[model samples]
Target: MKKLVSLLWAVTLLAALALSACSSNQATEALTGGDENLSLDKEFGGFGGGDESPGFGDPELMNDSPEDAQVSDVIADEPAVIDAMSSDSPVKAFFLRITWGLLEGDSSATEVIDWSGSAEVSRGTLLVLRTIRFEGNDFVHLPRDSRQKVEFTSQTKRHFDGLLLAIIDNDTTASDTDATDGTFTFVAGSFSKVLNFSELDSLDLLEPVGDMGNEVSIVTRAKDIVPFAGGFFAGRWVKTRRDGGEFKGRWINSLGTNTGFLRGIWGINRFGNKVFKGKYISANGEFRGLLAGQWTFTRGDRAGVFEGRWVNRQHKTVGRLKGHFRTGRAGDRRGHFEGRYRVTHRENAEGSDS
Candidate 1:
């Protein structure tokens, strides 16, 4: 890590501005005090010049008066780090593995999305991307519902200035075969909620990422993404039975990353994500019809999991569910989940159809 920082400092000094970031504070718990967290703010006072960069810290770090800056100053000085990512030459890249969860209009309905790309950050502008390999309009793991509607081919013009005003075509265009727009909100693991044009445009830009790595990710504001986020994911489910039969399913409302209602499952309880309250209808085919119960599945980006059991509307346990969950931020339930479970039917099962 020290070697990387030295290399970065060496390279940065030559490019435009000379940066002198103080050595990162090593973790107090470690014997060597190696900086496990690598908290940058305390390291360099927000990446500004420190005592190391000659003629750089005159005004800020050294607390030199105006006269000193004038005497030693040769030309106008640039910031220590401008757009830490997304530069024309070599911008920083944060390798994030985001497993997007959901995309409902709600702020909590974030889906599990794996992020594996870089955010080319520069001074004030931030550009993030995850290469989505195209396979007949579908990218890896990005369920059909999560794909954006806009397209970005060579012809499509993607736009971004600084804040979340970036643009994708809004309509599906001749887009690049693969792409994933970063809408980084909250912090590292916890991504922003699913948003649309209106929802996103109204939002403020999220804070920049701290450390850049596999654990890092960013979500683009819904408005900025509309122009180039590209592609579309319609919601539909197909369950293949052990026998030669399959029942098609779809959500009454789009189930996003966090919480949303599910519908049309031949056998199951209510919308079992977070709220875990919805109805289960019985289909006539190979699918056995079942009555409604209390069931929900809430996913967290980094830590929470709404698992355990299926319950009735009265909150009585009817069945059990087991799933794995991860954290997004400090708060539990702010992350996402994936799991499997079964529901128990009452002796006198009353069924209905919607």
Candidate 2:
């Protein structure tokens, strides 16, 4: 009886060990088989999984025991099936590769083409191109005639399907069957932003890109010049001093010679361009209308012509006087003053008196 009990216990122990070994092998097979599909999900989303589970009776991947885990038939050094790959859905590295031309073998070769400048698009429509390329390596710059064709063709490409603006080759013409030969270049992996007509006009980006194309061109729209200085004519012969106290006086016709005295304030304009527009007070306390004139200055001497209609206290054109004035006289107070007299008054000078 003691021998029979011991043999039975030994037999039970052997059976338990065999079952445990089978369970362990099954777990190992399950773990390894599921791993390959999981890896595909992380990398390429399982292109060839074909809805089959591991350790199934597919016959090709079936195992004799659970210990025989599923193994990938893929070669370790096989090139990626790019056609089957989702390259169109761009990745960070993909854009980096395209713009920067980083070569892995030959596709990413960095061949620099001449910078053709920039383009603009808006609301999915091509607007204008601001830059023109001169020369490029491994690429032909877009001919002026082919700009429109190239722009239209590029807008349809996979790389620029949704892009608003881009810089591309000029080979796409009506004559060329396959004109998309140039690579789109990018700076820091982004195409330039599109500019509107108003924005472009306001910013003044359109300019003669001087002899050197590398420099930035700035455009400025000009404004109309409104008269800032105009008033009562108080002075005909006015003197301006840099120190202070602007003189305002007028010239009056006298006996024998056209003797006239004047007084008015003289100063430069906002642009520092000389100007003298002020009220002219005659020696007889008669306030003439307004005198407006400009001073064209040179080295040590300055001269200009004064133009204005002289009016008396009754607001009448007593006598018109044309002043061909000059500052810094060589001697006397004579300059050049000539004009027609009023119908009532008569005062005429032969030539000049200094």
Candidate 3:
């Protein structure tokens, strides 16, 4: 519910903060009002349990060469997407709240791509399925092993990233270490989308890995993903202004801030790292602001007590959000996430560029 997003691109940066992020306009629908369903307790599902992500245990799955990126026999998204926790749990729970229908709407009726997210692992544990000439339901539903066929590929000298190549494209049993443009084919899922980095970048949602052609390992913990509600996330926040004061504001995701300083909409989309970026209407809400932060569990492994921070537009530290939300897997469940913020009133904000 709280997040980012991207496009041809607009990024916010501040010298005092180690974050560069953009806002998304896609999440405006949910921000109109608050949904009471978020009051339920959130569940935290553990990884050392029942769900399985099939990897090569047999000798054939191993790489013949040492340097090649290790591949797995995954029900790849295109081939396999990033490792998905239980679709019903981590994957499904998040998607259930998202407004999926308008994810990639085109102005003209002629459609080129279709995107869908699933709570079931078999369909794809992630969002945004980018493909062309695809007729199957999802990559996971395609041939399990080496039965998937590559339907078409762009003639560019493009190589799939490890996530796209390994998880969504290539199978563990077959490793085309020296995979070429046309020769390499795996019977897992079709990867018809152009492999060009720039083209992939055009897909606003895939910006997380737009900079590189390798696997971008984004390790998201329960703490980070669990607390988010996909809509209005309001909490008591502190500002380091006027000798420090506290205020309550809603954190709008995939869009801009909703209030002034101490509150504003900060757009967050899935990024390359666990870091979350946002823009705030700060400096007393009169000015446009930017904040970059990350989420983590303050206590043990679970999100019993979570923590995060945001650097204000004045290049001052203003947010230290500490709160809790119940973690659950099913989509219908709701969890309450409330916390207090302590402000650090910076008398003289530093850094002209933020």
Per-residue lDDT of candidate 1, residues 82-160 (tens digit): 2222123132222222222231112443332332222221112222132222123222221212222211211001111
Quote the positional error of residue 172 for candidate 3 in Å: 73
Kindly give the stretch of ten consecutive residues in candidate 2 with the minimal lDDT sum.
91-100
**Which runs in model 3 stand beyond 4 Å of their true positions?**
1-273, 279-289, 297-304, 327-333, 348-354
RMSD of each: 28.2, 45.3, 22.6
Q: What is the C-alpha lDDT profile of model 3 across 2-108, one tens digit per residue?
A: 24534212343342233322211112222211322211111110011111111112122112111222223333333224334222234211111111111111123
Top TM-score: which candidate number?
3
TM-score of each: 0.20, 0.21, 0.22
* Higher-scoring candidate on lDDT, 2 or 3: 2
- Better-scoring candidate (lDDT), 1 or 3: 3
List lDDT for all candidates, in order.
Answer: 0.24, 0.26, 0.25
Please give, for residues 220-318, the per-residue lDDT of candidate 2 as tens digits. 111112111111111223232331113323232211111223333334433444444333332232333333344443223433433444333334443
Question: Can you rank all candidates by lDDT, best first?
Answer: 2, 3, 1
The model with the greatest lDDT is: 2
Which stretches of candidate 1 lie above 4 Å from their native place?
A: 1-301, 304-306, 314-316, 330-334, 346-354
